[model samples]
Target: MDRPQIPLNALRAFESAARHLSLTRAAVELCVTQAAISHQIKSLEERLGVNLFRRVPRGLVLTDEGAALVPVLTTAFDRMSDTLDRFMDGRFHETLHVGVVGTFAVGWLMPRLRAFEALHPSVDLRIYTNNNRVDLAGEGLDLAIRFGDGSWRATVAERLFSAPMSPLCRPEVAHVLASPQHLEGQALLRSYRADEWPRWFEAAQAPCPPLRGPMFDTSLALAEMAAAGHGVALLPVRLFATYLENGRLARPFEAEVETGSYWLTRLHSREPSPAMRAFREWLVDAARAADERPDLLRENALSATDQSL
Candidate 1:
């Protein structure tokens, strides 16, 4: 059994006419005469043995067959156009869409983006910043830089670096803190995580204080709030290097807890494209390079802590 071979011109004519419901409009779009458009459509109908359209009093209307065929043709044409547009200047550009957490986006990735662009000139990289809540498949992301314990379902997680949580506050707020137990009296700002303060307290060998202050969805906001002298905020101090150096925030105590680490993740079902592979390699190498350097994160945290003391 062989399928009937149909001419592409006739298919195009039918699809265009069905979309506008007017052969005159289809002719204007296709740069063909109305009679040419009508001839191609009629040939197509003769071959298919079905009436694709009904000439109504006002304009043209699609029959059931035409309605069914229009969507399939429209989608096929759109995909083809998208594929063709990828070719530019003798190069096929690869588009890589990535989702990054807000803290990492501002503090880390923003600085290193130029290096990535310079290295991979053919990659059209798009970044979407999130508050550590993202969907890899639903949002159509190639990769996501996330903060967690590296345990997401249907995701292949790669450990990037550990971000130890510690108490950060304003200079005036730090003056009264002699030990972790002293934090009991201060207004403790918290994130959505309910156990972070308790976990830090457990590590500090002190009882967790009642959290009665404002809660933020992002560390960047918490950092600003802590810097503004609102209250003590338990944050990953390493990511707030600029604030610590500028005397906006201070690490009030040395006791820190390992709540989780940063991770580079992708859906398990997604095969890595060349651009995705390039980004992953670059990110991993960059993290490794950072780790090998003199520990600035510790130095900054200690320096801030010492300044407060």
Candidate 2:
């Protein structure tokens, strides 16, 4: 038998209600009355000859048939959305989607993006920021900059740079910090990862006390907190170089730890496009130049046209 004619409204109602598992919530989202949504769902179930939902005392629950249908609908909708996104620019430029860790973006990537645009004027670069943890394939990113040991499966990884952690705070706070032992008294800001403080303390040859302070999700936020004099933060020395140079922040002590490095990664299944290849070359060259510049140790000229990122 051929597929029965399904009303778009009824399918939409079912999709919304099935997503929320509540006709009332779905109705609110769709801007229709709850009763209308219920009617549409009922009509859909009747036409399809399947119970889509079970009306429980508290809320609606999806039936087995409804559960099985969700993934198919979700995929279809996502594909449609992706197609619409493709047509958004209305130009012939190739789209390059990239995901970068927040620290790398603010400290390293943002400064040098103009160079990428200047060098590859035709490539439409779309940048997304995440907190280091990213799925290269699932998120549809052509490339991602992540901090790790370079061992993600099914992806090719290239080392960008090693990031070392150290205690950073405002200059006023630094005046009182003669040695690492003095850090025990100051408010210690923390990151989502618990090991940063411990690692910095060990590197400093100071006692790693029980760290208790406001935990930030990203290192950039933690660095900002430190800049505000909220507390001292164990952060990547390279990332916060701008603040350190400009006196917005300072290193309280000289101890540092080489924790991990940033890696440029992409899915193994994808062959690098022209845009990607250009980016890879520029990125490798920039990283190499950074390594050769000894002035980068004292005052990282992060504001330069090519060196900003």
TM-score of each candidate structure, all chains considered together: 0.90, 0.67
lDDT of 1 at 103: 94
Lowest summed lDDT over 10 consecutive residues: which window, candidate 2? Answer: 300-309
Model 1 steric clash pairs: none
Candidate lDDT scores, in order, read 0.89, 0.82
lDDT (C-alpha) at residue 69 in model 1: 92
Per-residue lDDT of model 2, residues 1-309, tens digit only: 998788878878888888888888999998999999999989989988999999999898899999998788778777766656655446446789889999999898889889988987767898999998898888999999898899999999999888878778877787787888888889999888888788878777779877886788899888888889899988887777778767788775556788789899998999999879988888888877776753456344222211211
Off by over 4 Å in 2: 1-92, 299-309
RMSD (CA, Å), candidate 2 to true, equals 8.9
